[model samples]
Target: MGNPVQRPLPDIEDPLYQAHFQGLKDQQLRVQQCDACGQLQWPPRDLCKQCHGDRFHWPVMPDQAVVYTYSVVYRAPHPWFKEHLPYAIVVAELENGLRLLGNAFGADVEKIQCGVRVKAHFQHDEDSGVCFLRWVPTTS
Candidate 1:
């Protein structure tokens, strides 16, 4: 199958999401930590949801997580993902209590369920110099 002309990668140019993608490229999971209240959050925002703290730091999170929820997509919303139909989109809760959304592309979809253990899987695109964070079932 031909590769998609352009993959639907995250906008690395946006300052809000840059650090998260940079961490993935380095094989680390980074999240925003509020400097004011020490609150950890995902999908980095300009301010903390807890205390409305504008100052933050990007901290590398633990690679391990538990599958909080997931869904198998039978229909690909984008043509680029048509070849990957039936893949599982997962919301995994990190050890720090932050939930991050990822794709269980390489794992057996049937084995995915709530409470399953998973680990970070970084997929780097050489062409675009972009790194994507994925999740796969952990043997342990």
Candidate 2:
């Protein structure tokens, strides 16, 4: 048996995306919504892409989504990911039409396909107090 791999942690200190990380820690999915035009956006930004609004709010998003696309990585891109070989990376579209990218944990890489339903799965790191959002296949 070898030592467990330590995955890379995201920069939770980034102000623009802090809310998103915090939301995951709190077990909620948060996305940026333009306060001016009511547009929901991902990858938090300074200005709204839809209306160019400078003001925005963090709103909890639905956990359910449909897999828009996916890929099964047979080769690890980094040493930390070696133990997770053949993992599925998915891009799922939420009900609001917002797409989020995340790893499909506890999924059969060979069975993952487009149009599959998935749900958000939050994993918290005890050492760094960071929470990560993963996608998991759902029956319903």
TM-score for candidate 2: 0.92
Candidate 2 residue 46 Cα shift, in angstroms, is: 1.3
All candidates: CA RMSD (Å): 1.8, 1.9
Q: What local lDDT score does residue 42 receive in model 2, on the 0 to 100 scale?
A: 87
- Lowest-lDDT window of 10 residues in candidate 1? 1-10
What digit string (tens of lDDT, one per residue) describes model 1 on residues 1-140? Answer: 67556778777878888888888899999899999999998778888999998998999989999999999888988877787777899999987788999897744886789999999899899988999878889897
Clashes of each: 0, 0
For 30-79, candidate 2 gives per-residue lDDT tens digits of: 99999999999988889999899998889999999999999998888888
State the lDDT at 9 in candidate 1. Answer: 71
lDDT (Cα atoms) of all candidates against the true structure: 0.87, 0.88
Error of 2 at 103 (Å): 0.8
For model 2, the stretches where C-alpha displacement exceeds 4 angstroms are 1-5
